[model samples]
Target: MLKLSEIQRPIERELTIFEDKFKESMRSSVPLLDRITHYIVKRKGKQMRPMFVFFSAGSCGEINDATHRGAALVELLHTATLVHDDVVDNANVRRGFFSVNALWKNKVAVLVGDFLLAKGMQLSLANDDFGMLKIVSDAVQQIIEGELLQLEKARRMDIDESIYFEVIRQKTASLIASCCACGAASTGADDATVEQMRQFGEKVGMAFQIKDDLFDFGIDDVGKPLGNDIKEKKLTLPLIHALKQVGKPEKQRIINLVKNHNDDSQKVTEVIAFVKANGGMEYASSQMLAYQQEAFNILTHLPDNAYRHGLEQLVRYTTERNK
Candidate 1:
């Protein structure tokens, strides 16, 4: 029930410092690059990943210079991925704003993404934060692998619940897990504590993605258009579950719609109704709550404090967010 502002209260000052660090790290000499970067910075979404870093650091130990750098590193990598994703998805908007590619075109957006990635690496190398670098680097690899896996599955229309989980775990959860692990590492937390934080983050991330998938079925558009995932032929948990419950012919019908007629509004409406009738949304909601509870259980293992409370609120916020 805690508001986001309340959750951020404990680390308010640290977040300011992290913001300064992030802006400084992203500074560039090229005029176009600077303009685009400034626009990105200006239109940045809630710094959820950096908040994870600072909160996890505070939960394990005191925040320090290393924690600030860790926050910056994650943000930089996250921004890079988002820019690249906009191009890949042909997404014209992000977080309800015009995407980099929408304004500057794909070529500039891709180069800017690459530059951001390099800046992240340089930040880690300059500070000798190899541990942080490794965590983010592994996450980047997993994210790319997940995107490829999802693409492959979409092409074949063969993704099941297990494959769905794997895709979300890698594409979404891995980076959030890295946020917690790197935060704990920055504070010199023991390996056990770092692992615990990572597990907690992974569960929260799972819930986060489920909520996002649910948005695809919503009446009102969030940032992206409704059924955008369906248009892209990406079968999420709801559709996957619905497909499993139906008979072979009905299943094939759904698959055929997804495969051939995904762009058709009427077909998308039919698929959405089919999913609703088959308890797909209910099942996915249950799974999202399950992951949220699992994350809360992990939080119980951490010491009691405001930072721990912040993490708990974050779990709730992730599941409850409308957009």
Candidate 2:
């Protein structure tokens, strides 16, 4: 697999410029807000979403000011969601550091999330980037719906393969889809091209999420402990598929462990073994690869260039990452 640094070569300069602009966009008059936003800027992730935005824009047409704003808009929305999500999940850590809610409080974190969301909307509106804003806004709506849907289904522990896909599609894939669509729209691409890139991003996001699901079964040394999802009563792809393949009594027993004994290490291990015994890992891996191939196929129709090549490598990175 190509290192992210190597894959980033094409958009190195653009990313630097975006980093500065994104920081400036987070600035606020209030000292407390500034401090919180500064913390957020410092603990940023691998810049994957911005990379998607830049690469998609570069592939479609010239990278312009609109593209930069679009990238910032997406980043702002993503950061806001992460902040709110930490609050909802009652999580104290993120990316190995104390989350905003941990350092401050849930109230502060929620307000900060709202501020970032407003900033994103204002940035787009001030610059007349309505199309790009709409793309990301729609994604935000889908993300919320997905979360609510998951919560509802999780309480019953009744998610099937189809519901699982719908949850992931809205929860995880929609944001990346917005990234690609916003990127293309920023470059003045027509609706059809924008839609094409959106589908490409959705496919990659699907594969990316399945890979994450696999990590819960100890498929790789992903640094995190195993069965975190099971503990949360989150029925992921591998477990869902495995449940379908088992007899009713066996399925009920496993579900009981997940629902009532999830905190027990031995029971969690037993569930993981059951999933593996049922070929759940293999089934999920094949599904992930299928989505990856679909993403690559979408890229084939775009103009062959460094940007497109970078997007291809990025897709591979997401699906193949070790940690």
Candidate 3:
């Protein structure tokens, strides 16, 4: 697999410029808000979302000011969601660093998230980037709906393959879809081309999520603790497939363990073992690969360029990454 750095060579300079612009976008008049936003920027992730935006823009037309604004808008909304998610999950850590909620408390974290969201909208509106704003705004709505749908289904523990797909499509895929759509739209691509990039991004996101699901069953020392999903009583693709393969009694027993004994290490280990024994990991892997292939197929129809190739490598990276 090509390293992300190598894949990034095509738009390396653009990404560098985007960094400064994104930081400027996060600036606030309040001193405390500035401190918190700086912390968020310093511990930023791999810049995967911006890479998607730049790549899609380059492939469709040209990397321009609108593309930069679009990438910044996506990052603002994405970071806001992550901050809110940590508060909702009551998670103290993110990417091995203390989360905003951990250092600043829930009330502060929530306000910070709101501030980031408002800043994103303001930036777009100031520049008349309504197209990009609508794209990201729609994604935000989908993510909220997805989280709510998951919570509703989680209570009943009744997520089937279809429901699972729907949840991920809305929660995870929608954001990536917007990244690609915004990228293309920023480059002044027509509706059809933008839609094509959105479809491609959605497929990659699907594969990316399935890969994350597989990590829970993996024996390797992935950053997150093993069986974290089982502990949280979240039924992912592997557990869902495993449940479908078993007899009613066995299925109920496993579900009971997940629902009640999820905190028990031994029981969680047993559930992981059951998922592996029933070919859950294999089924999920196959499904992930299928989505990856679908993403590649979409890329083939687009203009052949270094940027398109970069997008292909990014899809591979998401599925192939260890953590």
Candidate 4:
């Protein structure tokens, strides 16, 4: 696994430049826009996307200006989407703070989100490279499509497990996969190496997302309120596995809890009991490990180097990360 300290230098430097653009946005003439944008930029996150961009680029050659630029671009794109997402989800809180929409009102939040999206587009185009223009543009479009698909399937109590996974592939994995692939692209890595990094990113992304779902069922590494998926009528993997194995009466009981989303903790507790009795948590945990191992196995095939080691650390962090 790559030491977090080893990568912290570049990641930290990248964040500095990221905050600059964000600050520049704040200096815009619109007072309401600046206020809402500041709310969204507060407490910047782990900067995972930009890190992937640099790390994957390093696999091909020395990290340089293009690397830093790519990192800043993708991370800003990610942050912008996050701001908009909070608005759409009606999510009052994010990153342990009031969401932009909640803090400054949805109108201001939406405008700030649009500003970020425009910046994301400008950031990539500023590269003055056509190939990246195509790649980043397509990724941006795919992100929207993925969100739309997820909204269509939202709150589906019995969403097909296969379909569920596909949704994750589209909604979550695509951006991460693009990070690695784009990193390789920026450095002109050979197709074979680029594809390997792409696949590696994809496997890790899926594993990470599945682990996130498992956390929703019981695990609390991310502090996302355990079992809230069940409470939200979202049929994540753990519950799906239990449903496949449990009796009709029990499944009916679980369904009732979801339908009664506003019910007390007793309602959530009842469904939690049913999941535990059927080994749902165990099932989800095992499945999560399977994906994690699959991610590591992909690492085994990559050329041995610090970059490969960095990727390995990401795999470890996928399941180990805590809020």
Candidate 5:
């Protein structure tokens, strides 16, 4: 496994350009919006999405202007979704800082999210990046549908493994798949290469989400509150697997606890213990590795280069990362 810094070294220059483009795209005439956007820029994450865009482009062909736009468009939509998610989750903290909704309240945050979304669309239209736009737009729609589906399942507490996969695929994997496909398309890669990268990204995204699901049960501080998913009634892979192994009565008891006492510290601890005891962690970990391997297999088809190596390291990192 390679360190993230080492993996990113291959595309550091491209990422720098992406950072500037991203910042410029977020600029607004409105003083408050500008301030909020600047705040967001200052506290941005590892730029993993844009890194994926650049690496995917480099793997298939040369990076070009369209690749930059693809990276910007993905980041714009991703940030907008995060803003809306904060409002929906009533989350005060994001990336260890106060979320936009926490600072400016729901009304401003909602508007800001809308503004970001429109800016992403405008970028695509202005550049006539319709191919990238279509990919991103489809991803956004799937993400919306995934969230709604998850919300519905969360309320019912009836999620199965298949449903869990579907939720994560739409909610998380679709965006990542679009990132790779857009990157490939931007470089004028053939349809076959674009599809291959899309598949690879989807597998990696699955592994990424599983790693995130594992964090809910981890002891280490993962930047967010532990058991946040459980509290939110989101049954992930581990818990879902554990449910399948239990007797009907035991499963019902677990479900009832999740429904009625999820917030209680003792109950959450008990649920976590039950999940671990039932081999939930092992099962989920194995599944995550399976997806990682699948992604690696797909990557083997692409022409090998430093970018491909970086992407391979990224797939490994997705499962191995503590956070």
Candidate 6:
């Protein structure tokens, strides 16, 4: 495994460029919008999608100015989505600061999100690469659809494993797939190489999300509220799996918690304890390892390069970071 510092160095450098482009795209003398966007810009994130695009593109072909621009575009789109997500969730804090919605209210946040999305589209169109435009458009469409799909799945207490996977694929894996595709889109990588990158991204996305669910069950200071998914009455894969394994009484009890919207402060703790006692958390963690391994396996087929090593290190870092 590569050191986290080594894997993050290139990503961090690119993030500076991403922020500059992002701020430039959001250009406005209006204090509110500027303050909002600036607050969001300075609040750092992992930049996984952009790094995925950059590394994959460079490994398969020459990394150039266009590739960097494409990477910036992905980050912009992702940030826009987060702004919108905060509104949708009515969230108070993100990345340890006041959310746009929390600071400025829903309308402002919504409009800012719209502006960000429009700017992202504008940047992608500037490239005159219709292929990339279509790719990003498709990704945006999938992201919206996935959000609605997850919302639709929220009340479903009996959401099956297949349904859970479908939600994961749409809500998380699609963007990751798009990131890898954007990389290949910028390069001479053949269809096989692009497909491999997509596969890797899919597995990585799955691993990333599964670990997130496990973190909800394990970590105390994720910054976001613990088990917000469950509180919102949306049972994730681990919970769904544990529900299936339990007897009727426990299942009904869990269902009642959902039905009542779970008033108790210890609800998450109790749910987590139930999951651990029944092996749901361990099952989720094991599955995360499986997907991470799958991502690493895809790397073996590509010829050795620093980018490839960086990618492997990134894959390892995902699991280790959560651990």
Model 5: CA > 4 A from native: 222-225
Q: For candidate 4, lDDT tens digit of each residue in 1-323?
A: 44556655544665567567555633557677666666556677776777788778876666666666566666666777788888888898888888888877788778777787777667667676455455556667777887776666754555767867777776677778778877877787777877777777777778778888866655466543366776666777777777778778877777877777525666766667677788777877786788788768867766688776676777788777653
- Candidate 1 per-residue lDDT, tens place, 151-237, comes to 998888889889999999999999999999999999999888888988988999999999999989877533333787888889999
- CA lDDT scores, all candidates in order: 0.92, 0.96, 0.95, 0.70, 0.92, 0.77
Q: Choose 3 or 4, whichever is better by TM-score.
A: 3
Best by lDDT: 2
For candidate 2, give the lDDT of residue 105: 97
Can you tell me which runs of candidate 1 are displaced by over 4 Å? Answer: 221-225
lDDT tens per residue, model 2, 97-206? 99999999999999999999999999999999999988999999999999999999999999999999999999999999999999999999999999999999999999
Clashing pairs in 4: none
Q: What TM-score would every model get versus the actual structure?
A: 0.97, 0.98, 0.98, 0.87, 0.97, 0.91
Which digits, one per residue and each the tens of the lDDT, describe model 5 over residues 1-323? 56788889999899888889999999999999999999999999988899899999999999999999999999999999999999999999999999999999999999999999999999999999999999899999999999999999888898999999999999999999999999999999888888888888899899999999998987754443377677777899999999999899999999888888989877888888999999999999999999999999898888889999889888888898877
Report model 4's TM-score to 2 decimal places.
0.87
What is the C-alpha lDDT profile of model 6 across 1-323, one tens digit per residue? 56656686755676667667656877768888788778887785767788888788867778766677677777778888888999988889988888888888999889998888887778778877555666667878878887887777675566777877777877788788778877877775676777778788889888888887776776566543377667777777778778888889999997787668565657766776777788788788888899999898888887698788778887777787744
Per-residue lDDT value at 1 in model 2:
78
Deviation from truth (RMSD, Å), model 5: 1.5
- What is the model-wide C-alpha lDDT for candidate 5? 0.92
Model 5 TM: 0.97
User: Least lDDT summed over 10 consecutive residues: which range in candidate 4?
Assistant: 217-226
Q: Model 6: which residue pairs collide?
A: none
